[model samples]
Target: MTELRISQKEFDLFRDFIYKEVGISLSDKKIGLVQSRLSKRLKALGLSSYDDYYYYIQDHKEEEIFHLISAISTNVTSFFREEPQWAYLRENINTIFASTRKIRIWSAACSSGEEPYSIAIFLKENLDHYKEYDIKILATDISKKVLEKAISGRYVAKDIAGLPKHILQRYFDIDKRDPQAPYAIKEDLKAQITFRMFNLVYDDFSIFKNRFDFIFCRNVMIYFDGSSQMKLVSNFHKILSENGLLFIGHSESLTRNNKEFKTVRPSIYERI
Candidate 1:
Protein backbone atom coordinates (compact mmCIF):
# COMPACT_ATOMS: atom_id res chain seq x y z
CA MET A 1 0.00 0.00 0.00
CA THR A 2 1.27 3.51 -0.82
CA GLU A 3 1.58 6.15 1.87
CA LEU A 4 -1.05 8.85 1.37
CA ARG A 5 0.30 11.74 3.41
CA ILE A 6 2.89 14.03 1.84
CA SER A 7 5.81 15.11 3.96
CA GLN A 8 6.39 18.84 4.74
CA LYS A 9 9.50 18.89 2.56
CA GLU A 10 7.53 17.41 -0.31
CA PHE A 11 4.73 19.89 0.20
CA ASP A 12 7.14 22.84 0.01
CA LEU A 13 8.68 21.48 -3.14
CA PHE A 14 5.29 21.02 -4.81
CA ARG A 15 4.14 24.44 -3.65
CA ASP A 16 7.19 26.12 -5.14
CA PHE A 17 6.79 24.10 -8.29
CA ILE A 18 3.20 25.26 -8.81
CA TYR A 19 4.14 28.88 -8.11
CA LYS A 20 6.98 28.80 -10.58
CA GLU A 21 4.82 27.14 -13.21
CA VAL A 22 1.56 29.06 -12.76
CA GLY A 23 2.13 32.03 -10.44
CA ILE A 24 -0.16 30.56 -7.79
CA SER A 25 1.31 30.84 -4.30
CA LEU A 26 0.36 28.00 -2.04
CA SER A 27 0.88 29.15 1.52
CA ASP A 28 1.94 26.98 4.43
CA LYS A 29 -1.65 26.95 5.63
CA LYS A 30 -2.58 25.12 2.45
CA ILE A 31 -0.33 22.11 3.06
CA GLY A 32 -3.29 20.05 4.23
CA LEU A 33 -5.33 21.23 1.26
CA VAL A 34 -2.57 20.27 -1.18
CA GLN A 35 -2.24 16.87 0.46
CA SER A 36 -5.98 16.27 0.36
CA ARG A 37 -6.29 17.35 -3.27
CA LEU A 38 -3.17 15.66 -4.61
CA SER A 39 -3.39 12.48 -2.60
CA LYS A 40 -5.89 11.20 -5.12
CA ARG A 41 -3.37 11.90 -7.88
CA LEU A 42 -0.78 9.90 -5.97
CA LYS A 43 -3.18 7.00 -5.61
CA ALA A 44 -4.08 7.16 -9.28
CA LEU A 45 -0.47 7.19 -10.38
CA GLY A 46 0.26 4.36 -7.89
CA LEU A 47 3.14 6.38 -6.51
CA SER A 48 4.11 5.76 -2.89
CA SER A 49 5.44 9.23 -2.08
CA TYR A 50 5.10 12.87 -3.11
CA ASP A 51 8.65 12.85 -4.49
CA ASP A 52 7.81 10.15 -7.01
CA TYR A 53 4.64 12.01 -8.00
CA TYR A 54 6.60 15.26 -8.38
CA TYR A 55 9.17 13.69 -10.70
CA TYR A 56 6.40 12.11 -12.71
CA ILE A 57 4.75 15.49 -13.17
CA GLN A 58 8.05 17.14 -14.16
CA ASP A 59 8.74 14.53 -16.86
CA HIS A 60 5.13 14.24 -17.90
CA LYS A 61 3.75 15.97 -20.97
CA GLU A 62 1.24 18.84 -21.16
CA GLU A 63 -1.78 16.63 -20.46
CA GLU A 64 -0.37 15.39 -17.17
CA ILE A 65 0.50 18.89 -15.92
CA PHE A 66 -2.97 20.02 -16.89
CA HIS A 67 -4.39 17.19 -14.81
CA LEU A 68 -2.31 18.36 -11.88
CA ILE A 69 -3.75 21.89 -12.14
CA SER A 70 -7.26 20.53 -12.60
CA ALA A 71 -6.81 18.64 -9.37
CA ILE A 72 -5.70 21.68 -7.35
CA SER A 73 -7.50 24.73 -8.77
CA THR A 74 -10.60 25.98 -6.98
CA ASN A 75 -13.85 25.99 -8.98
CA VAL A 76 -16.32 27.38 -6.43
CA THR A 77 -19.11 29.49 -8.00
CA SER A 78 -22.87 29.91 -7.87
CA PHE A 79 -25.74 31.60 -9.68
CA PHE A 80 -26.26 35.32 -8.95
CA ARG A 81 -23.62 35.39 -6.25
CA GLU A 82 -23.22 38.89 -4.70
CA GLU A 83 -26.60 40.23 -5.78
CA PRO A 84 -25.63 43.88 -5.66
CA GLN A 85 -23.36 43.49 -8.67
CA TRP A 86 -26.23 42.26 -10.80
CA ALA A 87 -28.40 45.05 -9.46
CA TYR A 88 -25.64 47.49 -10.30
CA LEU A 89 -25.49 46.21 -13.85
CA ARG A 90 -29.24 46.45 -14.30
CA GLU A 91 -29.38 49.93 -12.85
CA ASN A 92 -26.91 51.22 -15.43
CA ILE A 93 -27.87 49.11 -18.45
CA ASN A 94 -29.13 52.04 -20.44
CA THR A 95 -26.01 54.10 -19.89
CA ILE A 96 -23.69 51.50 -21.38
CA PHE A 97 -26.12 50.08 -23.93
CA ALA A 98 -24.58 51.24 -27.23
CA SER A 99 -25.88 51.71 -30.78
CA THR A 100 -23.90 48.70 -32.00
CA ARG A 101 -26.60 46.50 -30.42
CA LYS A 102 -23.76 44.27 -29.38
CA ILE A 103 -23.09 43.66 -25.67
CA ARG A 104 -19.72 42.09 -25.00
CA ILE A 105 -18.92 40.71 -21.56
CA TRP A 106 -16.05 38.62 -20.25
CA SER A 107 -16.53 36.27 -17.32
CA ALA A 108 -12.89 35.85 -16.53
CA ALA A 109 -12.09 32.80 -14.44
CA CYS A 110 -15.65 31.56 -14.63
CA SER A 111 -15.77 28.31 -12.68
CA SER A 112 -18.18 25.43 -13.22
CA GLY A 113 -20.55 27.84 -15.16
CA GLU A 114 -22.91 29.48 -12.67
CA GLU A 115 -21.63 33.02 -13.05
CA PRO A 116 -21.84 33.14 -16.85
CA TYR A 117 -25.30 31.57 -16.81
CA SER A 118 -26.36 34.28 -14.42
CA ILE A 119 -24.98 36.89 -16.84
CA ALA A 120 -26.89 35.33 -19.74
CA ILE A 121 -30.11 35.40 -17.79
CA PHE A 122 -29.54 39.04 -16.95
CA LEU A 123 -29.05 39.97 -20.60
CA LYS A 124 -32.06 38.00 -21.78
CA GLU A 125 -34.21 39.89 -19.30
CA ASN A 126 -32.94 43.47 -19.50
CA LEU A 127 -32.03 43.44 -23.15
CA ASP A 128 -35.12 41.68 -24.44
CA HIS A 129 -36.63 44.88 -25.81
CA TYR A 130 -33.45 45.64 -27.74
CA LYS A 131 -33.61 43.06 -30.52
CA GLU A 132 -30.52 44.43 -32.22
CA TYR A 133 -28.14 43.71 -29.36
CA ASP A 134 -26.08 40.59 -29.90
CA ILE A 135 -25.31 39.47 -26.36
CA LYS A 136 -22.09 37.51 -26.05
CA ILE A 137 -20.35 36.28 -22.92
CA LEU A 138 -16.86 34.85 -22.98
CA ALA A 139 -16.41 32.54 -20.02
CA THR A 140 -12.96 31.14 -19.42
CA ASP A 141 -11.21 29.05 -16.80
CA ILE A 142 -7.94 27.19 -16.25
CA SER A 143 -9.57 23.80 -15.82
CA LYS A 144 -10.58 21.91 -18.97
CA LYS A 145 -12.79 19.61 -16.87
CA VAL A 146 -14.80 22.52 -15.50
CA LEU A 147 -14.98 24.12 -18.95
CA GLU A 148 -16.58 20.91 -20.24
CA LYS A 149 -19.25 21.15 -17.54
CA ALA A 150 -19.75 24.86 -18.24
CA ILE A 151 -20.23 24.26 -21.92
CA SER A 152 -22.83 21.60 -21.11
CA GLY A 153 -24.85 24.41 -19.43
CA ARG A 154 -26.38 22.06 -16.88
CA TYR A 155 -26.68 22.72 -13.18
CA VAL A 156 -27.90 20.99 -10.02
CA ALA A 157 -31.31 22.36 -8.91
CA LYS A 158 -29.98 23.57 -5.59
CA ASP A 159 -27.58 25.86 -7.45
CA ILE A 160 -30.47 28.07 -8.52
CA ALA A 161 -32.09 28.44 -5.12
CA GLY A 162 -31.20 32.10 -4.77
CA LEU A 163 -32.16 32.95 -8.36
CA PRO A 164 -35.33 34.98 -8.77
CA LYS A 165 -38.43 33.01 -9.71
CA HIS A 166 -39.12 35.10 -12.84
CA ILE A 167 -35.55 34.77 -14.07
CA LEU A 168 -35.59 31.08 -13.21
CA GLN A 169 -38.86 30.52 -15.08
CA ARG A 170 -37.69 32.47 -18.09
CA TYR A 171 -34.13 31.20 -18.49
CA PHE A 172 -34.13 27.64 -17.17
CA ASP A 173 -36.28 24.62 -17.68
CA ILE A 174 -36.70 21.97 -15.03
CA ASP A 175 -34.83 18.79 -15.92
CA LYS A 176 -37.57 16.24 -15.40
CA ARG A 177 -35.12 13.39 -15.89
CA ASP A 178 -33.29 14.37 -12.71
CA PRO A 179 -36.10 15.28 -10.35
CA GLN A 180 -33.61 15.98 -7.60
CA ALA A 181 -30.98 17.72 -9.70
CA PRO A 182 -30.62 21.42 -10.51
CA TYR A 183 -32.42 22.89 -13.50
CA ALA A 184 -30.39 23.18 -16.69
CA ILE A 185 -29.96 26.55 -18.38
CA LYS A 186 -32.02 26.84 -21.57
CA GLU A 187 -30.32 26.65 -24.96
CA ASP A 188 -30.98 30.31 -25.74
CA LEU A 189 -28.85 31.36 -22.78
CA LYS A 190 -26.19 28.74 -23.48
CA ALA A 191 -25.89 29.90 -27.08
CA GLN A 192 -24.96 33.38 -25.93
CA ILE A 193 -22.05 32.21 -23.79
CA THR A 194 -18.88 30.53 -25.02
CA PHE A 195 -16.76 28.38 -22.75
CA ARG A 196 -13.02 28.13 -23.32
CA MET A 197 -10.29 26.51 -21.24
CA PHE A 198 -7.57 29.11 -20.69
CA ASN A 199 -4.79 29.74 -18.25
CA LEU A 200 -4.74 33.37 -17.04
CA VAL A 201 -1.08 32.94 -16.13
CA TYR A 202 0.05 32.31 -19.69
CA ASP A 203 -2.40 33.50 -22.32
CA ASP A 204 -2.13 36.26 -24.93
CA PHE A 205 -5.29 38.35 -24.96
CA SER A 206 -4.70 39.53 -28.56
CA ILE A 207 -6.39 36.45 -30.02
CA PHE A 208 -9.77 37.60 -28.63
CA LYS A 209 -9.59 40.48 -31.19
CA ASN A 210 -11.61 42.98 -29.20
CA ARG A 211 -11.60 44.94 -25.95
CA PHE A 212 -14.39 44.05 -23.57
CA ASP A 213 -16.82 46.74 -22.40
CA PHE A 214 -17.35 45.01 -19.09
CA ILE A 215 -15.39 42.28 -17.33
CA PHE A 216 -16.57 40.27 -14.33
CA CYS A 217 -13.38 38.87 -12.81
CA ARG A 218 -14.88 38.34 -9.35
CA ASN A 219 -13.53 36.04 -6.60
CA VAL A 220 -10.68 34.33 -8.47
CA MET A 221 -8.04 36.98 -7.84
CA ILE A 222 -7.97 36.41 -4.10
CA TYR A 223 -5.98 33.22 -4.58
CA PHE A 224 -2.92 35.10 -5.83
CA ASP A 225 -0.46 37.22 -3.92
CA GLY A 226 -0.27 41.04 -4.30
CA SER A 227 2.05 40.83 -7.30
CA SER A 228 -0.11 38.38 -9.16
CA GLN A 229 -3.16 40.50 -8.42
CA MET A 230 -1.40 43.58 -9.78
CA LYS A 231 -0.35 41.76 -12.91
CA LEU A 232 -3.89 40.57 -13.59
CA VAL A 233 -5.45 43.94 -12.81
CA SER A 234 -2.99 45.64 -15.15
CA ASN A 235 -3.76 43.13 -17.88
CA PHE A 236 -7.47 43.69 -17.39
CA HIS A 237 -6.99 47.42 -17.73
CA LYS A 238 -4.95 46.92 -20.88
CA ILE A 239 -7.62 44.76 -22.48
CA LEU A 240 -10.53 47.01 -21.50
CA SER A 241 -11.84 49.99 -23.44
CA GLU A 242 -11.24 53.53 -22.23
CA ASN A 243 -14.49 53.57 -20.28
CA GLY A 244 -14.85 49.85 -19.72
CA LEU A 245 -15.78 48.57 -16.28
CA LEU A 246 -14.05 45.93 -14.16
CA PHE A 247 -15.93 44.25 -11.36
CA ILE A 248 -14.01 42.32 -8.77
CA GLY A 249 -15.06 40.48 -5.60
CA HIS A 250 -16.27 42.46 -2.59
CA SER A 251 -13.45 41.26 -0.38
CA GLU A 252 -10.75 42.26 -2.89
CA SER A 253 -9.31 45.75 -3.06
CA LEU A 254 -7.08 47.50 -5.60
CA THR A 255 -6.09 50.32 -3.26
CA ARG A 256 -2.33 50.13 -3.72
CA ASN A 257 -1.16 48.09 -6.65
CA ASN A 258 -2.80 49.06 -9.93
CA LYS A 259 -4.24 52.53 -10.09
CA GLU A 260 -5.00 52.82 -13.81
CA PHE A 261 -8.65 52.32 -12.98
CA LYS A 262 -10.82 54.73 -11.08
CA THR A 263 -13.23 53.34 -8.51
CA VAL A 264 -16.74 53.83 -9.81
CA ARG A 265 -18.33 51.95 -6.95
CA PRO A 266 -17.41 49.45 -4.28
CA SER A 267 -15.41 46.68 -6.00
CA ILE A 268 -16.06 48.31 -9.35
CA TYR A 269 -13.56 50.22 -11.45
CA GLU A 270 -13.53 52.04 -14.75
CA ARG A 271 -10.51 52.52 -16.97
CA ILE A 272 -9.05 56.02 -16.70
Candidate 2:
Protein backbone atom coordinates (compact mmCIF):
# COMPACT_ATOMS: atom_id res chain seq x y z
CA MET A 1 0.00 0.00 0.00
CA THR A 2 1.55 3.27 -1.18
CA GLU A 3 1.07 6.56 0.72
CA LEU A 4 -1.78 8.52 -0.87
CA ARG A 5 -2.22 12.24 -0.48
CA ILE A 6 -5.27 14.48 -0.85
CA SER A 7 -4.20 17.16 -3.30
CA GLN A 8 -5.36 20.78 -3.12
CA LYS A 9 -7.68 20.07 -6.07
CA GLU A 10 -9.29 17.23 -4.13
CA PHE A 11 -9.68 19.42 -1.00
CA ASP A 12 -11.44 22.22 -2.94
CA LEU A 13 -13.80 19.73 -4.58
CA PHE A 14 -14.89 18.11 -1.33
CA ARG A 15 -15.10 21.44 0.53
CA ASP A 16 -17.58 22.83 -1.96
CA PHE A 17 -19.53 19.59 -2.18
CA ILE A 18 -19.92 19.32 1.59
CA TYR A 19 -21.04 22.93 1.95
CA LYS A 20 -23.55 22.76 -0.91
CA GLU A 21 -25.00 19.45 0.21
CA VAL A 22 -25.10 19.87 4.00
CA GLY A 23 -24.78 23.62 4.75
CA ILE A 24 -21.54 22.95 6.61
CA SER A 25 -18.73 25.39 5.93
CA LEU A 26 -15.26 23.97 5.78
CA SER A 27 -12.30 26.35 5.81
CA ASP A 28 -8.94 25.95 4.11
CA LYS A 29 -7.56 24.88 7.50
CA LYS A 30 -9.76 21.77 7.50
CA ILE A 31 -8.03 20.36 4.42
CA GLY A 32 -5.71 18.32 6.59
CA LEU A 33 -8.63 17.33 8.83
CA VAL A 34 -10.72 16.20 5.85
CA GLN A 35 -7.89 14.16 4.39
CA SER A 36 -7.07 12.50 7.70
CA ARG A 37 -10.72 11.74 8.52
CA LEU A 38 -11.80 10.49 5.10
CA SER A 39 -8.64 8.52 4.33
CA LYS A 40 -9.90 5.55 6.36
CA ARG A 41 -13.05 5.30 4.25
CA LEU A 42 -11.03 5.39 1.03
CA LYS A 43 -8.90 2.56 2.32
CA ALA A 44 -11.93 0.55 3.39
CA LEU A 45 -13.46 0.93 -0.07
CA GLY A 46 -10.10 -0.08 -1.61
CA LEU A 47 -10.03 3.20 -3.50
CA SER A 48 -6.74 4.83 -4.45
CA SER A 49 -7.79 8.45 -3.98
CA TYR A 50 -10.14 10.93 -2.31
CA ASP A 51 -11.58 11.80 -5.72
CA ASP A 52 -12.72 8.20 -6.13
CA TYR A 53 -14.35 8.21 -2.69
CA TYR A 54 -16.19 11.43 -3.49
CA TYR A 55 -17.63 9.96 -6.67
CA TYR A 56 -18.42 6.74 -4.89
CA ILE A 57 -20.50 8.67 -2.33
CA GLN A 58 -22.17 10.64 -5.10
CA ASP A 59 -23.14 7.43 -6.87
CA HIS A 60 -24.52 5.63 -3.80
CA LYS A 61 -26.66 8.67 -2.82
CA GLU A 62 -28.81 7.37 0.02
CA GLU A 63 -26.38 5.02 1.73
CA GLU A 64 -22.95 6.46 1.09
CA ILE A 65 -23.97 10.10 1.56
CA PHE A 66 -24.91 9.05 5.07
CA HIS A 67 -21.48 7.50 5.37
CA LEU A 68 -20.00 10.75 4.16
CA ILE A 69 -21.93 12.71 6.78
CA SER A 70 -20.88 10.19 9.41
CA ALA A 71 -17.28 10.75 8.38
CA ILE A 72 -17.40 14.53 8.12
CA SER A 73 -19.68 15.69 10.91
CA THR A 74 -18.86 15.53 14.59
CA ASN A 75 -21.60 13.77 16.57
CA VAL A 76 -20.26 14.73 19.98
CA THR A 77 -23.14 14.53 22.46
CA SER A 78 -23.86 13.32 25.98
CA PHE A 79 -26.91 12.74 28.15
CA PHE A 80 -28.04 15.93 29.91
CA ARG A 81 -25.56 18.08 28.07
CA GLU A 82 -25.87 21.89 28.39
CA GLU A 83 -27.11 21.87 31.95
CA PRO A 84 -28.64 25.34 32.01
CA GLN A 85 -31.17 24.48 29.33
CA TRP A 86 -32.32 21.49 31.34
CA ALA A 87 -32.49 23.65 34.46
CA TYR A 88 -34.57 26.23 32.61
CA LEU A 89 -36.85 23.47 31.40
CA ARG A 90 -37.22 22.23 34.96
CA GLU A 91 -38.23 25.71 36.14
CA ASN A 92 -40.77 26.16 33.37
CA ILE A 93 -41.91 22.61 32.70
CA ASN A 94 -45.33 22.96 34.30
CA THR A 95 -45.92 26.13 32.32
CA ILE A 96 -44.90 24.27 29.19
CA PHE A 97 -47.64 21.73 29.92
CA ALA A 98 -50.25 24.14 31.25
CA SER A 99 -52.67 24.23 28.35
CA THR A 100 -52.56 20.54 27.42
CA ARG A 101 -51.16 17.17 28.30
CA LYS A 102 -50.21 16.54 24.71
CA ILE A 103 -46.58 17.31 23.94
CA ARG A 104 -44.65 17.05 20.73
CA ILE A 105 -40.89 17.63 20.59
CA TRP A 106 -38.40 17.31 17.78
CA SER A 107 -34.81 16.62 18.66
CA ALA A 108 -33.69 18.00 15.33
CA ALA A 109 -30.14 16.66 15.52
CA CYS A 110 -30.58 13.78 17.91
CA SER A 111 -27.19 12.14 17.52
CA SER A 112 -27.20 8.65 19.02
CA GLY A 113 -30.46 9.50 20.89
CA GLU A 114 -28.96 11.10 24.02
CA GLU A 115 -30.90 14.39 23.78
CA PRO A 116 -34.25 12.72 23.03
CA TYR A 117 -33.76 10.08 25.69
CA SER A 118 -32.84 12.78 28.17
CA ILE A 119 -36.05 14.65 27.27
CA ALA A 120 -38.05 11.47 27.92
CA ILE A 121 -36.39 10.88 31.25
CA PHE A 122 -36.97 14.50 32.26
CA LEU A 123 -40.68 14.31 31.43
CA LYS A 124 -41.08 11.00 33.21
CA GLU A 125 -39.58 12.42 36.37
CA ASN A 126 -41.67 15.59 36.33
CA LEU A 127 -45.08 14.58 35.02
CA ASP A 128 -47.65 12.34 36.59
CA HIS A 129 -49.42 9.83 34.32
CA TYR A 130 -46.60 10.51 31.89
CA LYS A 131 -47.31 7.47 29.76
CA GLU A 132 -50.94 8.49 29.40
CA TYR A 133 -49.95 11.94 28.22
CA ASP A 134 -49.95 12.19 24.46
CA ILE A 135 -46.21 12.67 24.13
CA LYS A 136 -44.23 11.85 21.03
CA ILE A 137 -40.63 12.68 20.16
CA LEU A 138 -39.45 12.77 16.58
CA ALA A 139 -35.73 12.18 16.61
CA THR A 140 -33.94 12.75 13.31
CA ASP A 141 -30.35 12.82 12.14
CA ILE A 142 -28.56 12.96 8.80
CA SER A 143 -26.45 9.95 9.68
CA LYS A 144 -28.26 6.65 9.11
CA LYS A 145 -25.48 4.92 11.00
CA VAL A 146 -26.25 6.75 14.23
CA LEU A 147 -30.00 6.54 13.65
CA GLU A 148 -29.73 2.77 13.48
CA LYS A 149 -27.94 2.66 16.82
CA ALA A 150 -30.50 5.07 18.28
CA ILE A 151 -33.44 3.02 17.05
CA SER A 152 -31.83 -0.10 18.49
CA GLY A 153 -31.82 1.83 21.83
CA ARG A 154 -28.44 0.41 22.72
CA TYR A 155 -25.38 2.10 24.26
CA VAL A 156 -22.06 1.21 25.78
CA ALA A 157 -21.49 1.71 29.53
CA LYS A 158 -19.16 4.68 28.98
CA ASP A 159 -21.85 6.46 26.94
CA ILE A 160 -24.29 6.14 29.84
CA ALA A 161 -21.78 6.94 32.55
CA GLY A 162 -22.94 10.55 32.91
CA LEU A 163 -26.50 9.34 33.59
CA PRO A 164 -27.65 9.06 37.15
CA LYS A 165 -28.01 5.53 38.47
CA HIS A 166 -31.70 5.84 39.39
CA ILE A 167 -32.61 7.29 36.04
CA LEU A 168 -30.49 4.71 34.31
CA GLN A 169 -32.13 1.91 36.29
CA ARG A 170 -35.61 3.18 35.47
CA TYR A 171 -34.98 4.05 31.85
CA PHE A 172 -32.38 1.57 30.54
CA ASP A 173 -32.15 -2.18 30.60
CA ILE A 174 -28.82 -3.94 31.09
CA ASP A 175 -28.10 -5.97 28.00
CA LYS A 176 -27.00 -9.26 29.46
CA ARG A 177 -26.66 -10.75 26.02
CA ASP A 178 -23.96 -8.39 24.79
CA PRO A 179 -20.99 -7.33 26.83
CA GLN A 180 -19.97 -4.88 24.15
CA ALA A 181 -23.25 -2.97 24.28
CA PRO A 182 -24.13 -3.35 27.95
CA TYR A 183 -26.74 -0.62 28.34
CA ALA A 184 -29.91 -0.64 26.29
CA ILE A 185 -32.63 1.94 26.74
CA LYS A 186 -35.64 0.06 28.09
CA GLU A 187 -38.92 -0.19 26.14
CA ASP A 188 -40.63 2.44 28.28
CA LEU A 189 -38.22 5.10 27.03
CA LYS A 190 -37.95 3.65 23.53
CA ALA A 191 -41.72 3.67 22.92
CA GLN A 192 -41.90 7.47 23.17
CA ILE A 193 -39.45 8.17 20.35
CA THR A 194 -39.55 7.66 16.58
CA PHE A 195 -36.17 7.72 14.86
CA ARG A 196 -35.85 8.86 11.24
CA MET A 197 -33.18 9.81 8.69
CA PHE A 198 -33.51 13.48 7.79
CA ASN A 199 -31.20 15.99 6.18
CA LEU A 200 -31.88 19.33 7.89
CA VAL A 201 -30.29 21.31 5.08
CA TYR A 202 -32.20 19.82 2.13
CA ASP A 203 -35.19 17.87 3.41
CA ASP A 204 -38.74 19.16 2.91
CA PHE A 205 -40.07 20.73 6.10
CA SER A 206 -43.65 20.49 4.85
CA ILE A 207 -43.47 16.75 5.48
CA PHE A 208 -44.02 17.66 9.14
CA LYS A 209 -47.62 18.84 9.41
CA ASN A 210 -47.72 18.84 13.17
CA ARG A 211 -46.40 21.66 15.32
CA PHE A 212 -43.88 20.89 18.03
CA ASP A 213 -43.89 22.48 21.49
CA PHE A 214 -40.12 22.49 21.56
CA ILE A 215 -37.38 21.81 19.05
CA PHE A 216 -33.87 21.00 20.25
CA CYS A 217 -31.62 21.86 17.34
CA ARG A 218 -28.64 22.41 19.61
CA ASN A 219 -25.02 22.34 18.53
CA VAL A 220 -25.82 21.87 14.83
CA MET A 221 -26.14 25.41 13.51
CA ILE A 222 -22.54 26.11 14.46
CA TYR A 223 -21.61 24.05 11.40
CA PHE A 224 -23.87 26.08 9.07
CA ASP A 225 -23.08 29.43 7.56
CA GLY A 226 -25.01 32.52 8.73
CA SER A 227 -27.50 32.53 5.84
CA SER A 228 -28.34 28.88 6.33
CA GLN A 229 -28.71 29.49 10.07
CA MET A 230 -31.19 32.33 9.52
CA LYS A 231 -33.21 30.24 7.07
CA LEU A 232 -33.38 27.35 9.50
CA VAL A 233 -34.42 29.63 12.37
CA SER A 234 -37.19 31.15 10.27
CA ASN A 235 -38.52 27.71 9.30
CA PHE A 236 -38.46 26.65 12.94
CA HIS A 237 -40.53 29.70 13.83
CA LYS A 238 -43.17 28.76 11.28
CA ILE A 239 -43.58 25.21 12.65
CA LEU A 240 -43.53 25.77 16.40
CA SER A 241 -46.69 26.06 18.44
CA GLU A 242 -47.35 29.53 19.90
CA ASN A 243 -44.62 30.49 22.33
CA GLY A 244 -42.66 27.41 21.31
CA LEU A 245 -39.08 27.26 22.47
CA LEU A 246 -35.99 26.66 20.39
CA PHE A 247 -32.84 25.50 22.10
CA ILE A 248 -29.49 25.99 20.38
CA GLY A 249 -25.91 25.26 21.25
CA HIS A 250 -24.53 27.26 24.15
CA SER A 251 -21.96 28.88 21.92
CA GLU A 252 -24.54 29.68 19.18
CA SER A 253 -26.87 32.65 19.16
CA LEU A 254 -29.80 33.85 17.10
CA THR A 255 -28.64 37.05 15.40
CA ARG A 256 -29.55 40.14 17.38
CA ASN A 257 -31.33 41.60 14.35
CA ASN A 258 -33.54 38.57 13.73
CA LYS A 259 -37.25 39.12 14.38
CA GLU A 260 -38.51 35.52 14.32
CA PHE A 261 -37.54 34.70 17.88
CA LYS A 262 -36.57 36.43 21.12
CA THR A 263 -34.10 35.28 23.71
CA VAL A 264 -35.57 33.60 26.75
CA ARG A 265 -32.32 32.34 28.24
CA PRO A 266 -28.80 32.06 27.01
CA SER A 267 -29.07 29.62 24.09
CA ILE A 268 -32.88 29.58 24.45
CA TYR A 269 -35.18 31.38 22.03
CA GLU A 270 -38.97 31.64 21.95
CA ARG A 271 -40.89 31.97 18.70
CA ILE A 272 -42.44 35.41 18.47
Candidate 2 local lDDT, 51-111, one digit each (tens): 8988988898777877778888999999999999999988889877876989999999999
How high is each candidate's TM-score? 0.91, 0.95
Give one digit per residue, the lDDT tens place, for model 1 in 86-149: 8888888776775457778999989889988888777767764666787789999887778878
Candidate 1 — which residues are off by over 4 angstroms?
Answer: 1-3, 98-100, 179-182
lDDT values, one for every candidate:
0.82, 0.89
- Residue 179 miss distance in model 1 (angstroms): 6.1
Model 1 scores what on Cα lDDT?
Answer: 0.82
